[model samples]
Target: MYKFKILIEGYARTGANGVYFASPTSSLIYDEKVKVLVDPGTNADALRSSFEREEMEFKDIDIVFLTHYHPDHFLNIRLFPNVDLYDGTTRWHGDQEHFYEGRLPGTDIELVPTPGHTMEQTSLVIETVEYGIVFVCQDVFWWEDGKQKSDNVNDLLNNPDPFMASWKDLQNSRKIVLDRADWIVPGHGKMFRNPRRN
Candidate 1:
């Protein structure tokens, strides 16, 4: 079983458009053999402090998984240069592309495409000793006033902007997460249990 910890709990603030603007959440998962860092956000110093608090260093990270390429979520990837990175997209980073998806190559962690926040977004599912199936979902949904909300989906669907992709795809993705995840760690706000099951 793996051990997981939330290194950073992101925040959200409502904008003039009534849509909530969210910050990126970061976490770490490890066991006797595997050490993975999920979504290193825009703040490098904060991440560094988190590592220090956990008695770890930048060199200790074995794998980096980005839920998407949003600046808040992925801009700080340079902080961990030596580790393998996965985001399920074919994009170049300094002339090298490290694209990976589905179950992370050597580990049991599964990367599920959860596009809504972005076309290339991905979510993670991993079994742990404490929690049977823990899902680390980034911007697939958000929490507000202690209730899970999908304002982003509504915004994308209701808005007249032709650039936004199909909201149906995002709805299907959310269904996938709700149907499978036992516990959920959202991109912003606190980790919560699957209320439907409980």
Candidate 2:
């Protein structure tokens, strides 16, 4: 079985012009066979420090998984140098490079589409002894009890961020994740037990 850790808890904020700036939550998934980094967000300094906190270094990372093509989520990705990456989209990069999908070749981890914040986004589903089922879902759900919105039980049902690619798609994706995830490491917040479930 695999285990995971939140390398960097993510956050997002809105400036003028509906300009959304985000810090993608980066997580580490490591098992006997592989070491993976999901959404290696934009801040290289922060990422380096997070690695230090875990007593790890850059080269230790094996696979880099991009949930979507957003810059903030992928900017620091090249730091790993020649490691394999799952570009998180079906179409060849708009440049013809293939994107990997389904259960990863050597692991029990599976990629499930959880779009809406962006049409091509995907979430990570892995079974772990410590957390049961963990969903590293990026952006489909914001912080618990609201992201930009005020914090409250309303956050449980108020929907994800104010900005999204499609509301209808997001709602459908959220239902699947919130229903199945034992715990979720959201795109822009600390990991939380599924509030609706508990």
Candidate 3:
């Protein structure tokens, strides 16, 4: 069985372009042999503080999983050099390569493609004995105020030229997540019990 904890709860800010909520929501998943971090976020200090609060350190991290290439989510990845890293898209930086798609070898966490927030965005379906199936879907659905909102879809639909995502794909991805996830940890809010389930 695996246990997970939210390292940082993401937030949003308004900008001239409208609401810009890029603060990355990060989490840690661990069980005996594997200690994986999901989306370490942009603030190094905050991330470090969170680690300290959890009684953890950089040396404890075994792997890093980036939900996408967005700076807010993938920027602090350099902090964990000793671990293998995976990204939502295929890209390279010197010797470090971001995986486009794959499983984490021996882990129950499945890196499922959940595009629409971005063409490269991915979400994880972690099968846990305590939580059933917990879905870590960053930016796939934004939790704001006290309600869940499909901000990504709104962005794509409102734009004159929607290049990064499609409406149909976003809807499909939502269905997939809602179907499989019993609990959801979104990109910009607290963890919540998925109300869509029966």
User: Which candidate number would show the highest lDDT if scored against the true structure?
Assistant: 2
Cα RMSD (angstroms) for every candidate in the order listed: 4.8, 3.7, 4.6
Better of 1 and 2 by TM-score: 2
Clashes of each: 0, 0, 0
Give the clashing pairs for model 1. none
Pairs that collide in candidate 3 are none
What's the TM for model 3? 0.80
- lDDT by residue for model 3 (102-131), tens: 666557778889887787788988877777
**2 or 3, which is superior by lDDT?**
2
Best by TM-score: 2
In model 3, state the lDDT of residue 64.
84
Tens-digit per-residue lDDT, 31-110, candidate 1: 88878888998778788899889999888888787888777788888887766677755334566985655677677878
Model 2: residues with Cα > 4 Å off, grouped in runs = 14-21, 89-100, 143-154
What is each predicted model's overall lDDT from 0 to 1?
A: 0.74, 0.78, 0.74
lDDT of 1: 0.74
Q: Please, what's the RMSD in Å of model 2?
A: 3.7
Q: Count clashing residue pairs in model 1.
A: 0
